[model samples]
Structure formats: C-alpha cells, structure tokens
Target: MSGTAGHGTVKGRDFRLFWFGETVSLLGNGIAVVALPFVAVLTLHAGTFVVGLLTSVAYLPWLLLGLPAGAWVDRLPRRPVMLVSDAVSFVAFVSVPIAACAHVLTIPHLLAAAFICGCASVFFTTAQRAYLPTLLSDAELLSGNARLQGSESTAEVIGPGLAGMLVQAFGAVAGLLANALSFLVSWISLRAIRVTEPPPSPPPEVRRRRLRTEVRDGLRFLFRDRILRTLAVFSAVSNIALTGMSSIEVAFLVRTVGAGEAVVGAVLTLCGLGGVLGVLVSHQVSRRYGSARAVVICLCGAAPFTLLFPLTGPGAGLAFFVVGGVGVGAGVVAANIITDTFRQRYCPPDLIGRVSASAAVISFGAIAVGGLLGGVLGELSGVRETMWMMTGMYTLATVALVCSPIRKLRDFPESDESLRAAEAEKAVP
Candidate 1:
C-alpha cells in the first residue's frame, strides 16, 4: 500500500488520461486568448471599449451562474458534468466558423458564443477541481497539481504563438475551429477514464428547500473559514487587477507599443514561460519554505516588478514588459498551486464543490467587473495609463495575503484526516 501510494499518480492510467485531455484543452484555450480578441478587433472592427466588453462578457457567467453551478456539480456526477460542458462549448465555438463561412457572423453572435462558452466553463471548472481529490490521494495531490499546472503553463507558453500563425495563415476563424476540435478531444479523453466515482452522500429530503440550503451552506462555510476566506478575497482582488490588465493588453501592445498581432502573440508567449518556471519550482519551494510562507514570499517578491509594465515602449524598450511579465507569471502560478492544494486538502469532501464554486464566484466574478472597469478606464485614461493603474492595484492587492492568518502558520493543513481531527477537537463542547 505504501509503495502503491508513493508513485500513484505516476502509474495511474486514469490520471494520465485526464491530464492529457486537460492539457490539450488548455492549449486550445491559449489559442482562443489570442483568437477571440483578434476576431473582435479585426473582423468586427471593434474599438478598445468593445474589445474590453467582449472580454467582460465571456466571464459574465461566473457572476450569473457560478454559485449555482457549484451546487449543481456537487449534486451530480462530475464526469458527466464535464462531458456536457465540453459539448456545450464545442457547439458554441463551432457555430462561429459556421456563421463566418456563411457571411452572417457579427459581433453580437461572437458575444453570444462567448457567453455560452463561459457558462459551460463555470460547470466544467468547478467539477474538475472537485474531481481531482477523487483521482489522487492527499499525498499525491501536490505532485498531481504541479504536473497539471505545468502543462497548463506550457499551453500558455505555446498557444498564443500558434494562434498568431493560424490567424495569420488561415484567418481568425481557424482558432475557433481549433478550439472546437480540442473540446471534442477532451470529451473523448474524459469518456475513456475507468475510475468509478464514489457515490455522493445522500442529502435531506427537503426537495426545493434543499438546493438553496446547500448553496447557502457553501457560501456560509467559505466565509466562516478564516484561511479559505482570506484566500478567496486575495484571489478576487488579484483577478480584478489581472483581468483589467488583460482586458486592455492587446490594445496596449497595438496602440502604445506599436506591436502587430504576431509580435503581440510572441511577447505574451514569453510572459507565459514564467508560469512554467513557477510550476516547476513550486513543489521545491513548498517543501523547503512551506506553503504558507511560500504564498507570502511569492506574492511580495512578485509585486514590485509589475511597475515595469507601464514603462514598456515600442522597439527595444518592449523588453520591459517581458521582464515584468515573467515575474508576474511565475509568482501568480506558484501562489495558485499552493492555494489550490490547500483548498483541496482543507475543505471537507462533501463541500468542496460548493467551496470551489463560491470561491470562483468571487474570484471569477471580479474578472467581469475588472473587464468593464478596464474598458471604462482605458477609454478615459488611455491604455498605458490603465495598465499602470491596474498593475499598481495588483501590487497593493498582496497586502490581503500578507495580513491574513495563513502567514502565522508554518504550512497549510496536510491532509483530510489531519483537518478532520482538528475539526473534531474544535467541536468539543
């Protein structure tokens, strides 16, 4: 049992299959990161505000459906939820190329597609996060998560560059097609997993009252847990700043830095390399320094470099953004891996879906707010100024983590058993 547990993830056929599918899907998402905006700007002749609006619309589902999605995922089978999500995204994305081919594509149609895909993502992502603990034991989670983050970071590193070439060669519509195909591949890979999920614990027979009660319970638990609450707030604030930066980034490159599409893609790709570096280093950092301290150190260390972004310029000066991007990327991913692992281990198995969803509602919902803010700010203050404003906000957002209770701990809770034991002691009356 010890030997099997030690290298479980490495030898687990189901895990490898799941990881491969997610990796492919991540790469497709990377392509869309570049493709979707280009389609709005180039194909639809969208302005900076419209571009930001498009980005905001894509994340709007998190605000609208994030909490409910989490509750629903907890009540249903995770694999089927994921499969359904992929199918929805597949249809929504594939519709774009079909419309484009028939000459009926418009900005509204693209926005509708994005909104639909975003809704699918809320269910898929919440289920997937909850599902990971089922696949790997607590001891295997760090390594498993790191491997997943590494592949996702790699996708970020490669996706944009590929998107650029595809857009340049086959046009923007090709990226959506690529994304659709990727979803089909993900569906097939998930369908092939052989692990039988444990049956969900039965809920009370309250019918309509049960769903609302379960959803509220998730929200209540998240806010009641000090560590989870702090982490959730930190994520929400950081996402706002990050999404604001991203919302106007293409415009910043095109208008302020005088970059073409290919150059923009290449530069963003360079930024993504830092995430790969972060993922590779996270396990070692957590082991040596501990996860709690690692989060603070990573955030504090990465905060200052963001100031470098606003200084970026056309020609050789653009290297400033690359340097800043690398720092932000590495720090962000390291922080993410630590927090994600912590949540998986710390939350109760029954509540994780709701916890993930509730947390996501705050974090991802902030993204929507940030997107709109970025658009309004960009239109008023200009893109470079907005970058400076947004990046500066990110630097300040670390204060939440610095002051949080986690900083007092040596490390996050190690496992479900340890966490449950602590809870039992606290429950003594």
Candidate 2:
C-alpha cells in the first residue's frame, strides 16, 4: 500500500466487499447519531438528563455484554454474524417509524429501541474485529484501517449534515426511516461478500473448561501485553474527555455559540472532513515519520484543541471544524494501527473477539461516563468552559499513552514472515 485513504493497493477481495458493507453500515450509524437525540428531545420532548441517558443506553451494552460478546464472536461465523446483526438493527430502527406512524412513540419505548439496536452494534463490532484481520494480512492493515477510518470520518462529516437536513425537512422520525433503509442496504452488501477463514483449531475435549479458559486467557494476555494495556488505558481516559465533548456538542453550538442546528451540523461535518483527510494522509505520514511519531504529534497537538472550540470568530468556524476533525482522525488512526497491528500479530486467533470486546468495553464504558460528565459540566460551567476543560481531557489521553513503550515504535511489522513467526511462536509456547 502506497498511500492511505485506500488508494495504494486494494486489499483482499473479501476485505473489499466487507469494507464496503461496513462503510454503508457506518453511514447508517451516523444517521442515528443525529436522529436519536433529536427524536428524544425535539420530538418526544426529553429533558437534558434523558438525552444523556439515551446516548448512554446505546453504549451500555458494550460494557454489560463485552466479554461474552467477544467470546461469542470468536465462536461464530463472522459473515453471518455481520449479516444477522445488521438485520436486527434494521428492524429496531424501522420500529421507530412504525411507532411514530401509529402515534405511539414514547420515551420508554424509544429507550428500549435504542438499547436493542446498541446490542446489535456490539455483536457487529466484536465480529468485525475478528473478521477484519481475516480479510487483510498484517502488511495491509495500516492502509486497511486508514480506509476504514477515512470512511468513518467522511461519514461523520457527511452523514450528520445529511441527517440534519433530512430531519429538519422530513422530521426526525422520517429521517430515521432513511437510517433504517441504510442498514438494509448494508445487510444486502454484506450478503454478497464471500470470505475464507482458516477453521478454528478444535478445542480440548472438555467444553466449559476450554471456553472459560480461552476467555480468561485472552484477558490475561491482553493485560500482560504492555502495548495493549497502554492502548486500553489511552482509550479509556481520552474517550472520557471526548465523550464529555460529544455530550455538550449541541448545547455548545445552540446555547454557547448561538448557532442553529444546521450550522451545528455543518460545523460538525467540517470536523468530519478533516478526519477524512487525516485518515487518507495518515498512512503516508506514518510511513514518512513513523506511526508512533504521527500518534504523538496528533495526540499532543490536536487533543488540546477541543478546549479551544468555544474560542472562535467570524469565518473561524471552518478552522475549528477542520482542526478538530484532523486531530481526532490522526490520533485514532495512529492508535488503531498500533493496536490492531500488534493485536493481530500477538493475539491468538481464537481470542481475537474477546480481546477486542474487552478493549471496547473499557473504551466505550469511559465514553459513557464522559458523556454524562460532559452533560453535567455543560449545565454547571456553561458550554464554553466545559469545552475548555475538554482540551485538558484530550491532553490526559496523550499523557496516558506517553508512558507506553509503543510511543517509540518507529517502524511497523519488521517483516511479514517475522510477524507471523512471532504469532506462531506465541502459539507454540
């Protein structure tokens, strides 16, 4: 792979199809990001705490089901897991429109709906972590993750803007219908992809012993791996801050900055574009300066900028959007590449899902706390002060990583054979 943004070399055929499926699915997810709160607050008339809870509901499944989901994903057929998960999300989202049409949509019902969809997302994500490695070799992971991050960033930029306009134009309930349709589309796309995974080696004759052993083994290994431990810590602390920022985004734009929903959507979308650019360029940047260097630069520089969001002028909104997006994109790419590359290299094939889920549970669980704290911070300090504090949160994320040996990782995957040999070695002893 020459450049990031998926241009260097197209990866595995199965990966290509799988990537397309995920991209579409992410777009649908983006639609929900906009549609959910608006539906709760603007449509069903939810209070501030309720809105935060709605968001938290979406993340709760990760924390509650993480270990089990990971174990389950490891044991299942990934492609089918993906397809069925999307299908489940499809129905959960569609129910909103059906409920609204029937004039029966209410707060509790919506919460239940969001929780169900979130459950589906957990399965999809755990399966994805295991599935992606199967699609691309260690050599292609950087470019592959770049593409994935790029698509997500692009969706961040584009999807919300689209959601805002659609919600405003058609109403949030109607916009959700579009989101449902997007998931349906994603399901169809995944249905078409064919992948080949080496069958899992048979477990020992004792079933519960083997399963529980594998689960504990993954957790033990992840904690013992200095690199992954750092990644997990970095993910938790940084996400806590960022989630706080996310919690206050609407209030910051609407109350603090006095920008309307469309403006907020546009501003957020600009951040998305910056993220897309970061993802596209990160691979080359990693190659030129090294992945570890890129992570440090992004983490140190941009993470603090979250604090500066409230400090702006006329025509300055674009700068804020682009800079913030770039910071998020770059930091994420560096971290993911480092983590995925290492995990794929180090993790036993059987334990990938549990490790991935455990990591996510920690990260998203922090996000849940961050989002709640952000809401409280916004109400108490006002959006501007709260965001200024957000800058510190980003800084905290960097500091967490600063202590890690991975920070000095100057090169990636010394050699393919060597990388596999390392995995093989781990398997043997």
Candidate 3:
C-alpha cells in the first residue's frame, strides 16, 4: 500500500487504469457539453428557454436521487456502483444518435436522454469520490486529485475543439456517439482493476438503521462541521450563478455574439486552458499560502472577472469573454482541488459517500434552479441581460465565504479528530 501511495509517483497500476479511463470519459463529456446544446438549437430549433430547460433536466436527478444514492453507495461496493452507472449512461447517450439517424429524435427524446445520464452521474460521481481515498493514502490525495483534475481540464480543452470539427462535419448528434463509446472504455477499465476494495463496514447498529436515518446522519455530519458547512453554502451559491451563465452559454455565443460553431469551440477551449494552468499551480499555492487562504484568494480574485462575460461582442469584444473565462476557470479549478483534497482527508471513510452526496445535492440542486432561472430570465429580459445578472450574482456569492469562519483560518483542519481537539483546547481555557 505504501508503495502505491507514494507522493509524486504514479506507480500503482490500479490508479493508472482508473486515471486513464476517467480521462477518456472526461474528454467525451466535454464533447457532449457543446454537442448537446447545439443539437437542441441547430437540429431541433429549440428556444433559449427550452434549451435551459434541457440543461435543468440533466441536473434534476442530482436533486432527486442524491441523498438516497449516497446512502445506497455507502451500503454497496462502490466500484460496482460506478460500473453500473457507466453502463446506464452509455445506453442513454448512444440512443440519441440512433434516434437521429432514424429521423425520430425529438426534444423529448433528448430530455429523456439527459435525465437518464444525469441519474447515472449522481451515482457515479458519489461513488468515484468515495472510492479514490481507498486507492491513495492521505498523503497522496493532493497529487492524485491534481493529476485527475489536470486531465479533466486538458480534456475540456481538446474535447470542445474536436466536437466542433465533428459537429461541423458529421452533425450535432455525432458527438453523443463519442460520449457513449467513452463510457464503454470507462466500464472496461474499471472491470480490469484488481484492487480489492474492503467491504463497507457501517457499525452493526448503523447497518440496521433505516435508509432515511442514514441520509439524515450524513447531512448532519456535514452541517455540524463549521468549515464543511461554510464550503457547502459557498458552493451552492456559486453553482447557481455559474450554472445560470453556462446553461445558455452556447446560445449566447451563437446568437448574441454571432460566433460560428467553430469559434464557439475555440472560445470554450480557453476555459480548459485556464483550468490546466490552475491545476499546475494548485499544489504550490496551497503549500505557500495555506489551503484556506488559497481558496479565498481563488474565489475572491475570480469573482470580478465574470463581469466580462456578459460584455462579449463580435470581433475585438470576444477578448473580454476570453480573459474573463480564463480567470474564472483558473480560480474555480484551483480552489476545487484544495477543497476536494480536504474533504477526502477530513471526512471519515465510512461517511464519505453520504457526505459527498449531501454536499453535491445542495450545489447541484442550485444548478438546477440556476438553469431554470436563466431560461425564464432569458425569455423575459434577454440572454445578454441574464448573463449580466448571473455574473453579478456570482461575484456577490463570495460574501458567504468572507463572512464564514474560514476567513480566520490559515489552513483547514486535517480531520474530524483535529477539529474536536481544537474545540477541546478552546474549552480548556
């Protein structure tokens, strides 16, 4: 275990396999991010509100299934849960291209596909987060997370550009096929891993508890911790604004900015480029500035740049979107690396799934709300106006972090034990 868990080394075959598969899958997901909305706009001729509704539908499963899925994942073998999720998502996405080929692809069909894929994502994402700690020791977590996030960011760069070419040549629906095949690769890689995951060991009493009780306990654990609670609040608020802007981003570029499909892909690629740069610097920043401080710097510094997004125009004005997106992307990605590493190390292994799900439910639920709100506002006011509102809200959301106890700490507590020890010391005085 120590050999595999060494910092700055990627010697573990199991982790390598896992990383490869996820990187491939992430690339496909990047393609879908552009392709899915383009299909709605170009193929189905959906309006901005309807497109936003589609985005909301994709994330709705997280709000609906997040809590129970967390409890269920805790009770089951996590790898198997992830495998099943991959299978389900593959089937859901693959159907889209088939429907298009048959001239039977409707907006409802697209919605159903998005909803199904979202449901699978709720399970897969929760299980994947919990499973990572099993592969790497606490010392290796930051390195591992940075590697994974770096790959994801890189995929974000390559995938959109590739999707644009594919869409330009084959059609919007073709990108879904690439996504579906990536799922198959992920499934195979997971199947090949030989790591023997220890069975989940809830206390005998916990094993006998009702599922609802287990979920409540998870939520309780998260909210009871001041740092975690603060992080959750910040995530929820940030996601609402970010998702609102992203839900209509494709439409905004195509219709409002007058960017062609190829140009849209190029602009989106800048976001991934920023993410890669953030990943490269995250470890250094955390080491130099303290994890807590790094997070504050990222969020606070990035917030104002989002204002440039709504100011985008045709030729020279596009640079505003580019610079603003790169800033936001770098900030968000670097901050996420620190926070995710903290959660994995700090939370108890048994409660990881549930805690992660609880956190995600709040943030992702906000995403759903953002999507709907963006759509309604886009329809009522305008796409550009909605962008302004969302970006401004994103800038304001940082106040939640500024007001929290996080602002006072230099570094986050390492574990529940560290937090309790600190409290005990305070009480001794």
Candidate 4:
C-alpha cells in the first residue's frame, strides 16, 4: 500500500478527478501568463504604470484576503469552496472575450476582471493545499508531490509558448477563452469528487466566530515555533528576489546584453526543463543532502549567478543564464517542499485556509515590492547594475540559515510523527 488505503496509479476515483481537474486548470493558467499581459499592453493600450497596477492588483488580494479566506476555507466544505471559486474564475475570464468583442474592453475593466479572478485563485489554492493530505497517506506524499511538480513543470515548459502561438493566431481575446474553459472543466471535476469533509467545529456564536480570533489563531499557527518561522521568512525573501529579477530580467536581456526575444525564450525554456528535471530528482537530493541543507546550498549557489546574468558578452550571458535556470528549477521545488511541510505539520489541520493565507500574503506581498523595486532600480541606474545588486539581496536572503537551526541541520521530518509533536505543543493554550 502506498499512502492512503485503496491505492493504485489512479489513487482512486476522487484523486483522479481532483488531480486531473487541477492539472487542466494549471495548464490554462500557464496560458494566462502570456495572454493576460498581452491583452493589457496591446489590446488595452495601457502604460507601464497601468501594467504595474494590473500586476500588483492581481496580488493585493493575497495581502488583504489570505487570512480571512483561509479561515473561511477551514470553516466551509472544501469541495464547495473549490467549486464556487472555479466558477467565479470562469465567469471572470468569460467577461474578457465578451467585452473585447464589444470593443468595450478597457484597461480598468480588464484589471477588474483580473483582480476578481486572482482573489478566487487565492481561495481555491488554499482549499486545494488543505484538501491534498487528506486524500493520501504518509508514505505516498513523495510520489504524489512528484506528480504535482511534474504536472506544474510540464505546464510551465509548454504553456507560455502555446499561449503566444494562440494569441498570435487567434488574438489574445480568443486565447482567453481557453482559460475560461479550463475553469469550467475544473469546476465539473470538483463536482464529481467524493470526499466526506468535516463541518466547522464551533457553534455560530459571536465569540468564537469573530474575525480577530480567526486571524490570530492563523498567525500563531504559521509562526508559533522556530521551524515554521524560519521557513516562512526564508521562502518569502527568496520569492521576492525572484520576482525582482523578473521585473528587470527582460530589459537587461534586451538592452545590456543585446539579446533578442528568441534567446530569452530559449534560456527560460531551458530553466523550465531544469524544473522538470529537478522534480524528478528532488526526493533523491533530499535523501543525499538532507532537505534543508540541500535547499541552503542551492540558494547559496544561485546567489552568485545573479551577477553572471548582467555581465555582457556572447558566451557569458548564456553560461550564467543556464546556471540560473538549473538553480531556479531546483530551488522552486525546495521552497515548495519546505513551506508545504511547514503548513502540513505546524498548522492546525482545520485551519489550512488561514495559515496558507498568511503564507500567501507574505510571499506575494514581497513579490509586489520586489517587482516594483527592481523596476525602480533599473530605471535609476542601469539594468546590469541592478542585476548585480540583486546578487547581494539574494545572499542576504540566505542569511536566515544562520539565524535558524535549519541551516546546520541535516534531516527531513522523520514522518507525520513530527506533525503530532508540533500540534501537541500548540495545544498548550
């Protein structure tokens, strides 16, 4: 037997439906990466600032809604939350084509739609993360996460290119129809899944139902101990650096290195390939180096590569670009695993929504700042100089290992046994 009882490749009917639905939706989201910005800049004639607003607005819900939404996810039936969120996503996406056809699609309306969809995404994401461990057992988590990583990486490798081709052929408006359809598909799959989720625990009295208690409990759960706090802070900083780099990477490639779109795409595709490869090998790497130490070394190795990105010449950029890709693909898996472990072990089982919301908000908030600051620094100095600056920023991100014992440690949590220990400590008033 793998993890949960009744195991096969399909993992039973519910897992199959749940997995396929998310895979479909993620692929479509991959399409949105290319489509959303295209529509914002080309179709809507937005300026740089408007584009920034669109991107940042898409993230704001994580800041404002993550905790409350997570609490709500814990309180409600996870499947219904998943279904309704998908439906909301579908409706939000459908309006894009309708407005485009009417020639009534403005940047503000487009942003509005994106904001709505993004908010729903926060909800659906919280529920899905919470929903997963219940469906599998301890032994199967490795293989199950591998499947997820592979699916996500596969989507990354192919989705953007496909989106670009689709937009070029069909126009961005029509391409978004694919995203809308993906959401509808996900909704139907959710409807088919059979799981007996427990109802909320508390009575609907004013005291336990208050927003403050919910938010406070979530925060405490997310940061109550050494492990969770270290994981959260490190992950947040690393993601910020990644986002900051993205904001400026294209400009650097174009102006500093004189690279074309073809080169940029090719280099990123290589990184995506690295991600696919990384997921395949993550378990082995965790075993060999110990998960936390492996992640630490990966982060340290990647920091210096940031400098290589800015150094111009024919071969220099290519070498650094490839190195960065490998680092990123592997690093992403490391971060995902660490954070997921923290959530799974430390958070109250019933409070996945709120704790995840806290994590999401912190992570995404850093991303917004990183993107903004990257753009600002690039404008103030030069792109290459800005890239060099990030080398130090990223190095500082790794400094958390020094603050937390995870840096010196060399072990995975023995099992979900650690999860129980963490929970007992938390039950202490």
Candidate 5:
C-alpha cells in the first residue's frame, strides 16, 4: 500500500508479505536438502562423490553467473527477477517428481534440474538483497534483517525433520513435491505485494559500459573498500570450511555417529533452533556490545566449540554435536545480521546489487569447492577425520577478522554522512 520506502518495525504489512514468502521458500529448500541426496543415494544408489556433486552443482552457478546476474539485477526491477526465479525453481522441482513417477528419473536429469534451479537462485537472491533496502529505511535495516533471519531459521528448524518424515512415509519424491508447491506460494505472495518499486537508473556512461566492465566495476568497488574487502575474504574462507563440514555431516551421522535418518534430521533441526535463538537476541547483543565488536565476539569467540563436533560418537556422545551446533549456529547468525545490516547502510543504493553479488560470488563459490573437497577428503581420510580437519580450518578462518580494522573499532562505520564527515576531518590536517 505504500512506496518502496516504508518506516517502522518489521511487523509492517509489506515486510510481513516478503518474510512469509521467504520463510515458505526456505522451508521447502530445507526439505529438499535431505530429499535431494536421498533420491540419489537411496533411489539411484549413487555414491558419496555424486551426492557431494549435487551440492556443488547447485552453487556452481553463483561462481559462473554471479557477476553478470548482479549487473543485470541492477538494471531491472528486482521483484520481477524474483518472480521469474521462483517460476523457474517451481518448474525445475516439479519436473523431478514427474520423472520419478514415470520411472524415467536419472542422475543427469537431477543434475540438470539442480543446475537450472541454482541459476535461478543466482538472479533471485541478488535482486532480493538489493531490493531490501528499498523496503525499509537505514534505521530499520537491522530489525528487518534480524526478523528475516529468524523466519528462515524457524523454517530450517522444521524443514529437515519434515523431510525425513516425508521421505520415510511416502518417499523422497514427496519432499520434492512439497518444495515445488512452496515456490508457488512464494510467487503468489510476491505478486500480491503492494509496494511500488522506483525505476532503475543506470547513468548514460554506466549504461554504455561493457558487461565485462560492469562486472569488473562491482569487483573493484568491493575491493576498494577495506571493510568490505576483509569481510568478503573472511566469509569466503569461512564458507569453504563450513561447507566442507556440512557436506560430510549427514554421512558422518549415519555411518560414523551411528545415528538413524530421523536422528540426523533432529540434530540438524536443533542447529536451526540455535539460529532462531541467535536472531532473537542479535539486535540486543549488537546494541549492548557494539555491532563491530559483536561480530568478532560472535564469530571468533564461538568457533572453538567446533571441537565438540569431532568428539561426538554413538548414543549420548551425539549430543555433543547438538551443543556444538547450537554455539556455531547462534554465533554465525548474529554476526551475519550485524554485517548484513552494516553493508546495507554503508553501500550506495545503485551499487548494492553489484556489491552484494560480488561478495556472494566468492562466498558461494567457496561452498561449491568445499563440497567437492569434503567428498574427496572423506574418501581419502575417512569421514570423521575429515570433519576434524575441516573444523580446524573453519576455526582458523576467523583470524582474518582479528587482523582487520574492524577488530580495533567499537562500532562499525555507519551512514554515508558519517563516512564523509570522518573523511573531511581526516583531510582537515
């Protein structure tokens, strides 16, 4: 009912619509997370490498198409891009069930579906991140991000267990069908939104720039800023380690930890519950501890608990993973809310798409590589050992944050006005 610029809490009608859509989409994706690999491993009898490849393929589009997608999103209406992405995902997901029902499903078909949906995500996520600023003012950005993260985490908490149940009761195909239906719900919610988006504004010279140049410009902008550069590198490295650990987690639980399918799903659900708790308190923690300091505390401080994961074994020892996961999930979510809010407030509106894309490219690319690495390492060193090694790598990645300028500051820089004032003061001498 209002323009793109609305001010208030996240409870506003416009923000609720966006949040609800994303929550359903995330829940669908969560179900598919378990369902997808199960289809390969159980139905098709694929191996570890193939299961890992499924994840790698889904994220590979971020590396290949991320830059161009960002520039394209900058030039288009974000909502339309999101709608098209949802439609693409819907079709891709729906195809899997159809093929399964017809008994024509093959690994190649699954891979193709994953790759196509991944490409859709590349466009959709870039647009959505860029579009959020349009929906809320700077002051509300933190609240908005926290609320969104909470909803997503809530979905994560429920999705996996549901997936496990559906897979057990009906089949993995049932989860895929649920995911397809979720996208339809998301599309409808997005269509019903009443906020009017402003027109895209590429300057004459910018419009004339080559696609390569535009992509390079986004990369340049991210690297030119010290804070953005540091965070980007940190996130990339962290993703590599996190993905490696996650890629093997299901296998580790089923084989090494000696847990059943339902148990594994429950453990992962606890991880999401931790994320929800983190989001619930993130705003207060940032206000109390200082957002900049909170990032360091949440990340570097909590990472060491990853050792708990490696200590996990059969029966009661498995609860170690639940505790470790809670720490990691809570810490990571809070830090993300702080950093994302900072990025939104600090970056220029026009460049937000490119900037967000540039960061996502590296981070998501690392996830792809990490997935492959996990598979290889699992084969070579054994799954439990690989988890230990990857956890160490993740813990070490936090060193980048400690070395960055952000470590020395109480609060991260805020607003273009504050940035300009600080620059002017520096030049006064």
Candidate 6:
C-alpha cells in the first residue's frame, strides 16, 4: 500500500499489480499476434503482401506518433496516459470480433484496427517505461526488468498454443476477443494502484519550452551521448531484419513449410521458450561477463543462427526453423533486458519519457520498414528467397555493434559524467 520510490525491491503492491496486468496483457497480445495474420490469410484469403502490410500498419504509429506521444507523456501523468491507451486498445481490438460476427469484416477494417492499436501501444509503452522507475529504486531495475521480461516471454510461450487451439475450436475471432479482455484487466489493475505519483517537474527553462523544443532536447541528449547513439543505431538495423523476417513467417510456415495452424503455433511456442530461458539467465550473464560484453556476446552469437531460417522445409527440415528461432529469440531477449535496464538507469527522471520515445522512434520505426520490405520481397521474390535476404541482413547488422565504442568497454557507464571521464581517458592515449 505504501509508495516504493526508494525501495531496493519490486515487491510492493503497486508493482505486483502492474506486473500482473502487464503479464496478462502480453499473453493476450501474443494471441492477437497469431490471430490477426491468420484471420487475414484464412478468413479473407489474403496474399503475402497484404499480410505483410498488416504487420507494418500495426507498427506505423511508432513513426507517426512516437515523438509527440513521448513529449506529451512527459508533461502528463504517466499512469493516466497508460490507462487511456489501454481503453483505446480495448475498443480497437473488441471491434474486430464485432465486425466479424456481423459479417462486415474487411481487409480495410483489419488495417484500421491494427493502426488504432498501434497508436495506443505507442503511448502506453512510452508511459509505462517512464512510470516503472518510480516504483523501484535504481538498484532494483535489473531484477524488475528481468522479471517483467520473463513474464512476457512466458506469455509468448503460452499464448500462441492457446490461440491455435482457440482458432481451431471457436475461431480466429475468439483470439481477438481474448486480447480485448486483457486490456480491460490491465485498465482495472492500473486503476486499483494506490501509490500517488509525483507530478512532472521540468526546470524553469524547460517548462517554458514548446513541445517541439522539448522533443528536440530529448533527441539531442540521446544522440549526443555516444553509447546511446550507438545502441540506437544498432537496434534500428537489427529491428529491420527481425521484423522483416517475422512479417512473412506465417506465410512461409503455411505455404513453404506446409505447417498447419496448430503447427505454426507450436513452432512459435518453442521459440518463446528460448526467450524465457534468456530472461532466466540474463542477470548472471550480465554480472559475469559484464553488461557491455554480454550484449555483444548474445547478439553476435545469435546472428549466425538466422542462416538456418531459409533452409527450413517440411518434416525433418522444420527443425531448422525451430533451432534458428530458439537461438535468435534467446539472444535478443537477453540483450534487450540488459539494454532496457541500462536506459532506465542512465537517463534522467524528467526526460526518461522523451529519451525512451526517441530511442523507440528510431528502433521501432524500422519495424514498419521491415514489414513493408518483407511483404514486397515476398511478392516479388519467393518467400524462401526473401527469408534468405532478411536473415542475411540480420546477421550482418551485428557489425554495427562490433565497431561501436561499447566494444572497447566492459560495463556500461552509470552516468554521462562517467562516460565523459572514460572518453577523456581514452583520448589521452
């Protein structure tokens, strides 16, 4: 019931509520991830390009609204922003099943729903990241992030198989309804929290600045910092490849690999298991090898496995996809936990929202691009060929990290002053 601002642990009532709500929400999202594409492909008989476009539409809001949402979230109450976002998402997802039941569902309708959910996700994710630090002390962030990521990964494991069964028994629309309900739970959980968050306190000069000025300040801070900038660029490149491959994964599984709905879900579940494993070991990995080294090790080690994707086929060959996915998923999730904790600790409190948004705009915007590219390539080239290209790009993208200043360091700097001191020391040589 009490506030957890300076607490060294994340076991406070408010945090538990937050975590439970997020875990359920993520489970629903996992279901929707399979449901939406299956609906497009099975119910409507959509082609590869349309399916890819659907994925892109779901992420386009990050490009369209990310900056402004971050700016506004910084000025507003973060919890309320998250609540409103959840409400909006609930409406958007709930509409899908309603339209399907009415027999009025169309591709355009699906696209519209995806766009709306994407917009809500932008604000909700931005605000949630900013709100988390308030619930735990600096030392608690790593453990908290690991727990949250672990829950998310667990949802990924359960949700796909559940979605497959729901689609098989009831219908694809059933999955959407479940997702809609999850948002409602999240809304209730957020509302029940008793902790009173402090109001935003920008410096006098910052307070007078306009929205654009505030956004610019965040971007400047993010880019001016060498480590943050390097990580952002690496994420941007990696996301493009990752999203591109994912955009067409369902199509490839169904068409190229001859996987049924249940099989598709099963494969994704196995991959999610890898993510869970990553979360379990992320702390020890970072502690033993150092966060900086851990990130590089995870990414580079995972990159080569992507080559296995293009080789995936039916029967015994399906093992290739499973193996590749498990490796890549584990590495990406582990690296994300470290980097997310780093950003939360590294950025200042007042500017965390903007900084998070700025980083996301670059990193997540690439997702839209990747989705479109994957679809177009799937249409132009074969799905298998496109997979080859995307996976190859994914492997090559690691070079950005290998060459960055982070490669020279063991652990990441705790603050900008420490970073500057390190840079000065390096310069003297």
Question: How far out, in Å, is residue 45 in model 2?
Answer: 2.7
Could you give me the TM-score of model 6 versus the true structure? 0.97
* Candidate 3 lDDT by residue in tens digits, 109-208: 9999999999999999999999987788777889989999998899888888988888999999999999999999999999999989988877899999
Rank list by TM-score: 3, 6, 5, 1, 2, 4
List the candidate numbers ranked by lDDT, top first.
Answer: 3, 6, 1, 5, 2, 4
Relative to the unseen true structure, what is the C-alpha lDDT of residue 401 in candidate 1, on a scale of 0 to 100?
77
Model 6: lDDT to the true structure: 0.90
- Please give the CA lDDT of all the candidate structures: 0.87, 0.72, 0.91, 0.70, 0.86, 0.90
Candidate 4 lDDT (Cα, 0 to 1): 0.70
lDDT of 6 by residue, 336-426 (tens): 9999999998898878999999999998899999999999999999899999898888877898789888898789888787888877998
* lDDT of candidate 2 over 1-429, digit per residue (tens): 121234445555667776787787778777778778778767887655566677777788888877778877777777788788889988998999899989999999888888888888888988877887677765676567767876787778787788788777888887678778888888887777665565545465423465666567668867876556777888888888877777666655655566666776777777676566666666766778775566666566666556556564335654674576556765665556545655666566667788888888888888777877776777677667777787787787687677677666665444335655766887995
The better-scoring model by TM-score among 1 and 2 is 1
Candidate 3, residue 362: CA error in Å? 0.9
Q: Which residue pairs overlap in candidate 6's backbone?
A: none
- Candidate 2: minimum summed lDDT over ten consecutive residues — where? 1-10
Question: CA shift at 266, candidate 3, in angstroms?
Answer: 0.8
Q: Which candidate number has the best TM-score?
A: 3
Q: Please report how far candidate 5 places residue 375 from its true position, in Å.
A: 1.2
TM per candidate comes to 0.95, 0.88, 0.98, 0.86, 0.95, 0.97
Clashes of each: 0, 0, 0, 3, 0, 0
Q: Candidate 3 at 214: error in angstroms?
A: 0.2
Off by over 4 Å in 2: 1-8, 11-13, 210-212, 312-322, 412-429
RMSD values for the candidates in order, in angstroms, are: 2.6, 4.4, 1.2, 4.1, 1.9, 1.7
lDDT per residue (tens digit) for residues 1-429 in model 1: 111356425558888889999999999999998898888877887888878887899899999998888888888889999999999999999999999999999999999999999999999999999988778887788788888898889998999898888889998888989998899999999999998887666556633456778889899989987778888888888888888988888888877789998998899899899899899888778879988899888888888878888899888888988888889889989988988988888888888999899999999899998998898899999988898888878877887678788788778776546756776998999
Sliding window of 10 residues with minimal summed lDDT for model 6: 1-10
Candidate 6 local Cα displacement, residue 82, angstroms:
0.3
